[model samples]
Target: MAVEVVSGIVLGSREYGERGMVVQLYTRELGRVGVMSYAGRGNDGAKLSPFLRVLSTVRVALRLGRHAEGMPKLVDVEEWERGAQRGWSCEKMVVGCFIGELIQRLLEERVPNEDFYLFLLERLGLFAAETQDEVVFLMVFLLDLAKSLGYAPQGEYTVSNRYFDVAHGAFCGRGEGEGADVIAGADAAVWGRLLDGHYLADLHDVDGSQRCRVLYQELRYLEVHSGLRLSLRSLEVLKELVG
Candidate 1:
């Protein structure tokens, strides 16, 4: 059997049957991979399933097949950096879930993007370590995630050309069209600040409501540009937590 060890983040985990566990993990080596992650069958399956929680950062050894016949099998887990550990508060878990869902939705399987994986791992580790009472962490994470995904917004935001076109992914003098593509006036200005290389660590003073609005707009921008209609269920919960 071909075997390899990799650092991975668990995007999602679910039970299959009486004693089956499956996980979707994004790794630096292989990108998004679905694996039947059972260290043992029957009652002994409890040994490893407890550690493979969603949003956990883990080092896993996978048993690979000679031919690409089916999904790989997780044979051993060396380390588990769980996001929802014993001391983790509800807010931390919520942020982890929201970001996990967004990444899982935005990323496609088998697309090997090393930069994206590293970006996610670094920010995931950071977010896991700190729990804040604001939405800045989420927004900061979005900025990196957007850049990693190759759509960190384009053009500059100015008074004469202030409208943000989500579909075009650039600011314009006036929006090219109506619908989700157009964001104008104060809202557009807020987006420009939030996304226009003006990260929180730089210069930003957005309040709770403005932050939440920018979050919504960021999601919309991603949806329009990613070629997928994103419906992040955790978004509303994240918004409520921040708003």
Candidate 2:
């Protein structure tokens, strides 16, 4: 088998047998992959434990095509030193898990999207810093993710046509069928600002309730486009944390 070294972030993990684990990783070179690792009770287990932590970044040596069914085997793992040990607050942890789950659900297996991988890395850094408005950060990240998936809401906003048609993923004028999917009025205006590249710092004047409303609209837009019920488990936790 050919051995390859790659950088990845742990998306999730589960125990296998008595001394091994099956881990889901989002790799820079291989999009998403499942690898098996043996980490029994000893120094070896201690060394590999960090790699199983959700959102932990690591350099791993994978024995490609090791399994008869063609699953990769994890030969070795080393946690990257840069910002590796920064402790995340409870809120950050929940948000990070939510992001990981979203990626795992939305992406296909073994399809490399380097831009999205780099975007995750950048957002991880920002989360580690823990200095920005977390709610706004998440909203922006979701918008960017939607764009990467090729179904982001249209950024064309006019004073007259301020209603965001979520089902169509565009801004529209006041008309019939302006119900849940049609974000109109003040909510539409805020959503437009987010799509126009206004970051958290630029949105200081906006209050928390309005930010939450925009976030909900953005999520609804994504659900409409992707056709996936992203009823994320950590969503309630995130909402409580942000509020």
Candidate 3:
């Protein structure tokens, strides 16, 4: 097969055969793809372990594999960019992990959407250099990703409509099924603005609990619409860091 060059960040990996790995990436062109690496140390595939490790960026040439119909094999690769990943604070790393996990779980395989890819790449760039906005950053990411992936909730929050429903992707009034898993009150308001693409400065002032509530509500909305579940292992650590 012909070589196709793509640029992206390593999402995560799992051990394959005894000496192999299936490394997944969210790419600018290919969306989400996995490349097989069984080459011994010092070889092309093995060289990727370090570069692909820890959220580093890479540009790689991949060709369709013989064994799998769609999976590709790593041919030639180069570090597309560096230093930014190393410079991210421990907290930012957790955010990065959350972003990576979200990207991996939400994106379908092989399909490509350059707009979503660039949007993701740009956000990672912001998270690297920007600080004190981590929670809002995650909130914005969830909003953007939701919209980009068609999970964005509709409607505005108002005094009468005090609840935002996740499954329905819209705001509703009390007794209108504010039931379990719904975002209510100020949290709902904030999420409503987030879904509307409004990033008011006041968003930065919301206290930890409100911040947590809005964040989790947006997350549930995203997950519910996407039908994806996340372990979110880094979430508590991330919350502590941001707070």
Candidate 4:
């Protein structure tokens, strides 16, 4: 098999056997891939562990699956960037874990999306930088991820039509069906600002409580649209932090 080289960020991993493990990575060239690595066995094992940590970016050489649908084997890995291993706060780590889990759940294996890949890279870098509000960043990331996945809310907010209909993915007038997905005008405006691509720095003036509300609404939107019960363990930690 021909060796393929790709740059990727580790999403998550699980121990497969006593010595081997399955690592999930979102690659620049191949999107999300699951490869088997022996991380408990040789000298390379020690080196691979750190590089495979969640959100760690690396360049790797892979031995492609022989049957095309089989699992690929990890040949080697090189760290692309390094940051403080233990410097991340509890909030940051939880948010990072949530993002990783969300990506792993939403994307299909071996399906490549270059734009989404780049977006993930940038967001991960921002998280690593640790200069922004983690909760606010997470809310923005969820909105952006929804846009990438094609379920982002549509239509511009106007004075007359300000309510965001999460079920319909659009702005509508008040008294719009009274579903649990309909966000209030204030919250709808916040979602609009985020969907319009406002940076976290620009939104820094927004109160943390409002940000948390917007995030909850966005997560509900995702749940309604994607039909997946998202894992909220990390989100619980974030809620406590923000409050």
Residue 31 CA displacement from its true place in model 1, Å: 26
lDDT of 3 by residue, 58-166 (tens): 3322232222554233332233333434444444444554565556555533233556655656655565565555667788778887887776677788888878878
TM-score of 1: 0.59
Candidate maximizing lDDT: 4
For all predicted structures, in order, the TM-scores are 0.59, 0.61, 0.61, 0.62
Model 1: residue 38 alpha-carbon error in angstroms: 14
Residue 60 lDDT, candidate 1, scale 0-100: 25
- Given candidate 1, what's the lDDT at residue 134? 28
lDDT of 4 by residue, 1-243 (tens): 211122234343454222222223334453433432333333222234333434442332223222355533333222332344345554554455456556655553224355665666676666667556677778778888788767877887888788888888888888874777788767777877787764454676668788878878887888788754554443554555565
Over 1-243, each residue of candidate 1 has an lDDT whose tens digit, in order, gives 211122234333354322222222334454433333432233322233433433353332223222254433323222233323546554554555455546555544224255665566666556656544426677766756666778877777797877888777778886364675588877777766656432334424566787788778777776666753444334545655666
> What stretches of model 3 exceed 4 Å from their correct place?
1-82, 85-87, 108-112, 196-200
Candidate 4 stretches with Cα past 4 Å from truth are 1-86, 108-112
Whole-model lDDT, candidate 2? 0.54
Arranged by lDDT, best first: 4, 2, 3, 1
Local lDDT at 29 for model 2: 53
lDDT accuracy of residue 3 in candidate 3: 21
Deviation from native of the Cα of residue 188 in model 4, angstroms: 1.4
What residue runs in model 2 are displaced by over 4 Å at the alpha carbon?
A: 1-87, 108-112
